[model samples]
Target: MARRLFLHVGTPKSGTTFLQSVWWANRDALLEQGLLLPGRGVNHHYWASCVVRGGRQVDTIPAAGLAAWDELLAEVSAHPGDALISHELFSPAPDERAEAALRRLEAVADEVHVVLTARDLVRQIPAEWQQRTKHGRSQTYDAFLDMIQKDEQARFWRVQDVPGVLRRWGQGIPPERVHLVVLPPPGGPRTFLWDRLCELTGIDGTGMAERATRSNESLGLVEVETLRRLAGTLQDDGMPKSTQRLLKDFVAEQVLRTAEPEKIVVPARAYPWVVERAQQMVAELDGQGYDVLGDLAGLVPGSEPIPGRDAADVTDAEVADAAVAALARFVRHEELQRRRGRRRPPESSLRSRVRHGLARRWTALRARAGRS
Candidate 1:
């Protein structure tokens, strides 16, 4: 039992990956300062666990190899220092799940604080759909926008329904215990998402480290089209789960290490509409009166902030060029990573054998090819 169990419940796409990276990078330093971030297998097995719980058929991992969710909870309770669990999908849990999380946290924690970091959904949804595109989702930006705003069949909630998400999770947990870190601002120090997160998470400003686990998604329209086309081929070829996992795992930690996870996606450009809608939703949330942070900005009815338009209005020719350049960069980065990985790791005998086998004949073969 720790003095505080700070559950970083996410409202997603609000720099959750960067926050997790910071915490993991400084885990040893944080431990010295009485902060403990525990996961199932020494790593925050949170995503794997979440995939087990809510991921679609494609996300389905091996059930037999999957560790029970309750066992994961026990590990969280056993850890010393101020406990912290971060997984963005935990936003508004199902009634039973939320109740279970709260009960377990209450029994083990001296006190509990729900830390929610949110960006204006006006900006978040389109970026999210761009992400969905990166992950092989074929839904168009307009279609995804419709679902985020109005479709109930998908079980998507209004992004402005922040308090509702809390209400679901905070049933037994007290209202006072919840904290919110809002992105952007009503005024003063237009907060970049990272700085605000650092302020709230207690990570020292001077000690920033390289992020771990590169972003799971990033794509401009053409790259998205490429992936969408790939997904269609996947359906035809019956791509195996194991094959997808191997590629994604490497891509996450390696290929994306240098990739611009955020591209100027059209879906991102259309986000202002989502902002307007979210403003109405936030107004309703504000009336309910809960722990609040971050202004909904232009989304609020009377308080609509002028949209700071980025280069989204660029012509199709410009967009096509940008997309082409982005694809080149992504492919180049992946190629470099492949070369580096092959050159490195001779630790295992199998790797040594593979390395020697490549080294022994590859130069001669390359020389022959060059002559030809």
Candidate 2:
């Protein structure tokens, strides 16, 4: 059995991707130091979480197979040292499912600790809207905010309600063992969050940040609006979820993120409501006995307004410009693939026959040269 198990449930859009990237990149080094990141790949934990939660599938992602949960548990049980399981998807699990997962986790380790990382709603709101776009949802930013505010069942609150998430996942675990790591406001050191994780887990994370290669890069306002439009069209055409996922991975992450358009930020009109909500969350978290690693005051947004145009305010001209740039990028990528011969040639084309003939002749020449 593992000695200690750290389950990092998440408040999404709070630097979870960067943390996971660093941990996965340094998994071998961490293993030598007695901290085990179980499973075969970076996304293994996410798939396992899906299985554990009754095969609940996230938008556009396929459901994990029934064996995923068992495989993850097997890895944890086999590890002799501390093990960590992390996924933002684990945050919003229903109460019974969350309890079931905790029960299984508790069976494999001497102690179970629930870790949550969170940032202010002022940032999370817009980020969550953009995330929905990536998942092929076409809901406008205004509609997303309205849903989250008015609907208790909004998916946003399920994951982003810091105090609520802790209460749900922290059940049955000792309050002191449940950890909340607050993400500091922007402009701090890049390694600050990693440092916090290391401090909590007692693992040496030196230089791990340099090794991390993945980031959940945010899209600019125009870029995201363009994606939202594309998503709506694809959904109308009944595009396969797998194909949508590919577009999100390639076009959104690779092409759209390179644009320099203005970023999405909370509208000035929403500041009062955002501030009030943040204060309420901080007040609730203050009373919770869970161990907090950073200042609770950091959860509250600042009085000064954040600068950036609302996503809804993005102009048609801006979206057109982004779309044209993305199209050009796709063309360039296709040309590069053809040049590198990564793309298959048409089977009936003269070019294909010539290429095959050249390949056979080259082989014959190599054979003769070797004999000589």
lDDT scores of the candidates, listed in order: 0.54, 0.80
Task: Give me the runs in candidate 2 sitting further than 4 Å from their true place.
Answer: 55-64, 345-372
TM-score of each: 0.70, 0.89
lDDT of 2 at 154: 83
lDDT of 1 by residue, 136-238 (tens): 4556556776676566434346223565667776777776677666666435463355565555556554554454444445444444443333334344434
Candidate 2 per-residue lDDT over residues 340-371, each given as its tens digit = 98965555333232223323433544455466
As a whole number from 0 to 100, the lDDT of residue 363 in candidate 1 is 45
lDDT assessment of candidate 1: 0.54
